[model samples]
Target: MSSDEVTDVIDPRPARRLDVPFQGFVVDMVSDEVDLGEAGGIVRREYVDHPGAVVVVALNEDGDVLLLRQYRHPVGAFLWEAPAGLLDLDGEDPHVAAARELAEEADMNAASWDVLLDLLPTPGGSNEAVRVYLARDLTPVPDDERHTREAEEADMVVVPVPLEEAAALALAGRLHNAATIAGVLAAAIGRASAWETLRPVDSPWEYRKN
Candidate 1:
């Protein structure tokens, strides 16, 4: 099958957003006004329209997963998370973005990449979504090739946790980041399948343009 065809996804019909009134870095605020025809009532709901992103689950030979500790001003905490980045670059593949972030944040490279899971973390309030990639066969980039860190990332800490411990932290609620929690659990499931269950790194991203 082609990369654009996702056999696992069943979608005969889907809703498409028609109105976008605002856009910003934090979130693209939008208002959807609706009418209740029965009683002639009207309603408006405001929400965030995200550009989506990718998260990487980088694992080594011993099954240790690379994680990052970075301070987020909004949450007022230095949270532990898998390396991830926004899909801000036009025409960039999600898998490529994931690999770029893993290198930038962890100074490592992966020879194998697969889509572990796709999640809409907060569908009730936002169209923000994340695609988690499982990356293995790790290698470290040469020091000269590593990207320079800035801003919050300048103080970021890279830590590798055993797969079991990482899963525990995610399941027990210690891993507060949404992508990290989902990625760890998804990796656990992928391990059970001997990694055969994972989708191709370039699997169809039906929601990328939504």
Candidate 2:
């Protein structure tokens, strides 16, 4: 069968979904702890609530992927990551939000996009679902329309890195951001397969295989 005719069969298995009640946030706390049962059951759990977010993996016509290096206050250092942000509480769609974040952080707009995957960022603690999108057919736009926190805070610099290099970075322990690494590698593999299918051949691989 042709590559296009190939189908991925997925096993349908449901996870044990937990319904946890939200508690109030702490303005200040010295230490908070959770107690788990001896049998690996949760007796108590404490965590800060967070909303879902979207991560964009944008690729330009040259096949380079866009990335951002920004300072994370919590980490106290700069980290490479894809353009992403929390969803708008007013019920903004995740795909639209991903596109918006791409433009806001990278100053580029995608003509085509596909949602690669959605995953729970921290299943153990929080329920923040991060949706990853693969963006293509990129075009530059005005920087003034981009989102900004403060004049100096959260400076977003758009960097175009080759997809191969990005994947190498991830494997070499450079790309530490979970969402970004996952999204980039997914897109890279997809693009590679697409390129392979489109390559010119005498017999065409599909017929040869058959």
Question: Residues 142-171, candidate 2, lDDT per residue (tens digit)?
Answer: 766656655423565678999999999999
- C-alpha RMSD values across all candidates: 5.0, 10.3
Please report, in order, the local distance difference test score of every candidate based on alpha carbons: 0.86, 0.69
The best candidate by lDDT is: 1
Query: What's the lDDT for candidate 1?
Result: 0.86
Candidate 1 residue spans exceeding 4 A from truth: 1-22, 34-42
Which pairs in model 1 have colliding backbones?
Answer: none
Model 1's C-alpha root-mean-square deviation from the true structure amounts to 5.0
